[model samples]
Each structure stands twice: as C-alpha cells, then as structure tokens.
Target: MWYFLMSDAFTFGAFLISYGTIRFSVNHWADPNQVFNAFPFAGHANLPLAFVSLMTFILIFSSVTMVLAVHEGHKMNRKGVEKYMILTIIGGLAFLGCQAWEWTHMITGDHTVLVDGVLQTMGTTVTNNPWGVAADPGAITAALQKTPDANLAAIVHSLGHGGTADAHATLGRDQMISTIQAANLHVTTPGPIAFGGYFFGITGFHGFHVFSGVVINVIMYLKTKFGHFDQRGHYEMIEKAGLYWHFVDLVWVFVFLCFYLV
Candidate 1:
C-alpha cells in the first residue's frame, strides 16, 4: 500500500505541476475567487471558497476518526473500530455529495456573455468558459441592443432585480433592459478553455480517490463488525486502510490549495 500510495503521489504531483505551468503561461486565467464564490442555497451571495472549506474540514475530521480507529484496532477494540470507520465513511459520502452539488451548479449555471455583438447565455464546460475577462462597455451596450427580450429578462433576473423566475418571466422587455442598464452588471468574453478541462480532470480524479476510500472504509467497517479482524489476532488490515485514507486526505489538501486556494 505504501508503494502504491507513493506512486500515486507522483502522479498527482505531475498533474498539479503541469496545471501550474499552464496557468502561469496563460495571459489571463480565471480568478479562483470569482469562480468559486458560491454557496449552496445562498442565491447570488458571493462566498468565495466557503463550500470547499467545509469539504476540507470534513475530510480532515475523517482523517482524525481514521486515526482513532487505528488506535482502537491496536487495542482490539472492535466497537471503537466500527464506530470510527462508520464516521469516516459518512464523511467521505458527505464530501462526495458536496462535490456533486458544486459540479451541477457549475455545469448548469446561466452566465450571460457577449458574442459577435449578441448576448448569449452559457455555462462552464470543457470547451466553454463563462468567467473570462469583463466585456468592454461598448461591447456590452451593443450586445444589449441585439439581445432578445427573454434573454434580457433572464439577465435582469440573474442580477436579483426581477424577483422569482416566474414573476421575472412576466416582466416587459423594456423594463428588463432598463433594470440591467441601471445596475453595475458585467459580462465576460470567455476565458481560457483549459480552465474547465483541468478543473474537472484533477478534481474528478481526487473525487474518485475519495470515493474509493469510502468504499474501503465500508469494507473495513463490515470486517470489523463480522469479527474478521479480531479473529485474525491483529487488525493490520485496518492499519493499512488507514494509510490509504490518510493519503487521500493529504492529497485533498494539495488539490484544494492548487484548484481553490492558489
């Protein structure tokens, strides 16, 4: 397990290094603060890195529980092992749930952008970036003139001016356009395509490791519950699993630093 983990660390290190290289080479990379400034159930409130911080806390806490489980295993305390393992599994699942919501939010989010003197809505994806540099005032004004009534209304609603979607949809086009022009609204011109690529790739890889760790913890929990480790006169299996779980947690710290913090 140690050898495997060391090799895995090398792989992750290479990915992060490459990501940094490309990020620095780019003239304009998306701002992490703006990109991650979102919280679940908080409409339009800018909370930078808040959700990811919660995920980091949960993973670190799970690592602590894993350590406790390992210590319990040393004393042949089956009940303690079961309890900590369950906690670890729950933490892993919670992290996965948070990640799922973040992914959905990013992919399905509606971002207004100026393209060819026309305003269009798009979301972040491997080939598209909606978090680019701010569009020029001239370009924005031109696009607004060419924007459809419904699109204009959507933009007004996104800025928190037109009420609920249902109510916002009933608003007149002239009123929607007037609301948008009165507000300090800014649209983007599309950022580097590699931004979304690396984001999904590296984060997805880390999430996979987290999911695998959760599965291993579940198996370990079952083994403890069934007396498998106790019958063997030792719980070395739990210790090995602990090594992997800890490694996963450590990798996340770097992942969070690379993708979210730095």
Candidate 2:
C-alpha cells in the first residue's frame, strides 16, 4: 500500500508541477475568481469560492467522521464504527454530487451574453473560448440574433439589467464586455487553454480518489455489518481506509489552492 501511495503521489505531483509550470509560463490565464464564481442555482451570480468552499467543508467534515470511526474501531465499538462510517459515506457522496454539478455547468457553457443584440452562449473548447479575447463580436451578435428571445432575455435579466428580451436585446461590444466584467465573468483576450486542461485533469484525478475511498468505505461498512471486523479481532481495515481518506482530503486542499484560490 505504501508503494502504491508513493507511486500515486509521484503521478499527482508531476501533474501538479506541470500545471504550475505551464500556468505561470503563460502570459494570461483565466482568473480563478472569474472562472469559478458560479454557485448552484445562483445563475452566474458572483459567489466567489462559495461552492468549492462548501465542498471543502464537506470533505473535511467527512475526514473528521472518518477519524471518529477509526477511534470507534480502536475501541472495538462496532455500532460506533458503523454509524460514523455511514456519515462519512454520505459526505463523500455529497461531494461527488457537487463535482458533477460543477463539471456539468462548465461543459454545458450555458452562460449567455448579449453581443450586438444577439444572445450568444459562452463555452470553452479545447482551443477557444467565447468569453475571451478570441470572442468575435460579429459572430456573437449573429448567433444571438438567432437565439430565442426567452433565452436571451433570461440571461440579460440575470445580469440585473432589468430589461426584457425586447426592451434591451442588444449591447455594444464595450457594453457587453463591461456587463460580463461587472458580473465577475471577466476573461482575458488570450486565455490559456492549458489552464482548463490541467484544472480538469488534476481535479478529476483527486475526485476519482474520493470516489474510490467512498467505495472502500461502503465495502468496509458491509463487512462490519457481517461481523467481519469483529471476528477478525481488529479493525485495522478501518484505519487503513482512514489513511487513504485523509490523504484524499489533504490533497484536495492543495488542488483547491492551486486551481481555485490561486
């Protein structure tokens, strides 16, 4: 297990270091604040670090529950172990749900902006961004012109412009940029795609770890249900799982700092 952990650590370390190198090497990268300011049901409102912070809280609290389970294990308190383990599993699942929502929001690129009276959806691709310097005002306007008024108006209202789709359907280029920035949706002209790539890779890797930890915890819970741990005369399995869960939670702190807070 130690060897496996060391190998995995090396892998994550390499990925993170590479990300940092490329991110800093670039002249302009997307700001974490602008990139991750959306929250669930907030509709692109500026809730900087709020959702991720909640996720961090959930994982950290799960780590605490895991520790308590381990403590119960040391005491050979089967019921206590089972209870805390269940709590830990729930926390893990919640975190996964949050990640799913975040990924969906990112990929769907449903963010809309009025570019010359045309409502255009903002999205990210492997090589381009509709919200960055590469954004073509003409194309955006043309696309939005085809978009449904209901869709365009919803976005405009969300930005607090108070105009219905028909009332304020189009915006000048400068006004569009200003509206996006004012809503904390700022992006640079030459945004780095590498930043998005690395962000997804590292976070996805860490998320996989969390998922595995949850699976392991569930298996251990089932085993405990069957009296496996009590019959074994030790709950060392719980401790082992605890170590992995804690490591996962710890790694997320760094990931959060690098990809979100930084």
Candidate 3:
C-alpha cells in the first residue's frame, strides 16, 4: 500500500519537474512575476509569495522538533510531546495557507500587457503557445531520432532547420513570442510532445504533495486535540508525519531552484 501510493506520488512530481524544464527551454520565455502573484496589496511589492520559501525552512526545522517530540514521547514526557507536536502542526498549517493563497492567484491567467510598443506575455501558458511558421512536431521528433548523441550540434541543426526553435536571433525571438501570442489557445507550442505535456504535468504533481500533507496534518491535529497520541505510547505517528512533511519541503527546494532560480 505504501509503495503504490508513494510511487505514484513520486513519479507524478518528477514528471512535472521535467515538464517545467522543457517549457523553459523555449526561446526567451516569460518571467514568473508577470505570470503569478500574491494577494492584492502585496502584489504591488516585488515579493515572490516567498512565504512558501520560508515554509520550506519551517518544515525542516519542524522535523527537528519532531525528533524531540519522539524522544520525549519515548521517555513518557507527555507535556514535551504535546508541546512540540502542537508547534509542528501550526507550522504545517501556515505552509498550507501559503500554498492555498498561491493557487488562488496562479490559476488565473496573466492578463495581457503592452510594453515598448509590443505585446509580451508573462504567464506559463506563454511557454505553451505556438504560432507563425510553427515547427513540425513530427519533424522535430524525427530529428531527435536522427541525432547521433543528443549533443548540442545535432540539436542546433534540428532547430536551425526548423527556423530557430532554440534561442539565438533576437528579432526572431520577438517574432516567436508574437507568434505564440497569435497561436495562443489554438495550437500547442513548438518542440516535441514532452514540451507541453511536462509544463502542467510536473507542477500538478508537486501541488498534490502539498495538498496531501495538509490533509494528513489535519488528521494528526485532530488526534492531538482528542489526546489520541498522549499516554498512548510512542509518537511515531507524528514522526511519520514529519518525515512526509520534510520530504515535501525538500522537493520544493529543488523545484524553486530549478524552476525559479534560473
């Protein structure tokens, strides 16, 4: 049971990660600021919904508290166990609120913006659009097949033949953005199937983790409220909860690094 549930979760998160990678590889992709944001007043500020980043650190620290909780629970120090466990639940809840607010903002597309006498996109969907002299996915697939070693030269030739799919020419880059805008909502963006597939696929997977952890922590919180954990022996339940929480935070570290840092 654990294997199946966890394997599915892990696979989904990893796939979404790969999807994000392929999306960014597009020529002069959109920035995250224009794509997503915090609540109204905070939006004017340059904050990155960075609460999520702080949550990651809080979760890691909570794991340390969990270790203390477990140690105290084993020694039958009911007060210490309760104290740390309650604190851990609060941390998890704070993280959940951050994620919920983030989603509330993310699902809505970024409205169009006019800049420098040209339209430039800001949302993730921009990465998915394809318009104007679009590259043939089938041909791109064939090129991938034709490549000798998946090296730069082979890929460059593939893109060049298809008219600069890779980033290089500045004017062409602008045109491609305009093209994707024109192609917006009508066709999938250029490149292989993996490109569009991964964009939505990977992040959805990670979001699922955050969701599940919230549910589990809520359950733990209830049991604590009912005194289900105290005087009942070890707090392995909380320990296991902490393990999953830490794993979620650790993955976000990578997600933030790979998706945003670049």
How far does residue 60 in candidate 1 sit from its true spot (Å)? 0.5
Q: Across residues 1-262, which tens digit of lDDT does each residue of candidate 1 receive?
A: 9999999999999999999999999889988898888899898899999999999999999999999999999999999999999999999999999999999989877788887787777778888888888999988987888898777767766776537655775777677777888876778898889999999999999999999999999999999999998889999999999999999999999999998898
Name the top TM-score candidate: 1
In candidate 2 the C-alpha lDDT for residue 157 amounts to: 55
Report how far off residue 140 is in candidate 1 (Å).
Answer: 0.4
Comparing 1 and 3 on TM-score, the stronger one: 1
Task: List the lowest-lDDT window of 10 residues for candidate 2.
Answer: 181-190
Tens-digit lDDT track of model 2 for 47-92: 9889999999999999999999999999999999999999999999
lDDT winner, 2 or 3: 2
Alpha-carbon error at 103 in model 1, in Å?
Answer: 1.1
Clashes of each: 0, 5, 2
Q: How far out, in Å, is residue 244 in model 3?
A: 1.6
Ranking by TM-score, best first?
Answer: 1, 2, 3
TM-score of each: 0.93, 0.78, 0.55
Judged by whole-model lDDT over C-alpha atoms, candidate 3 comes out at 0.52
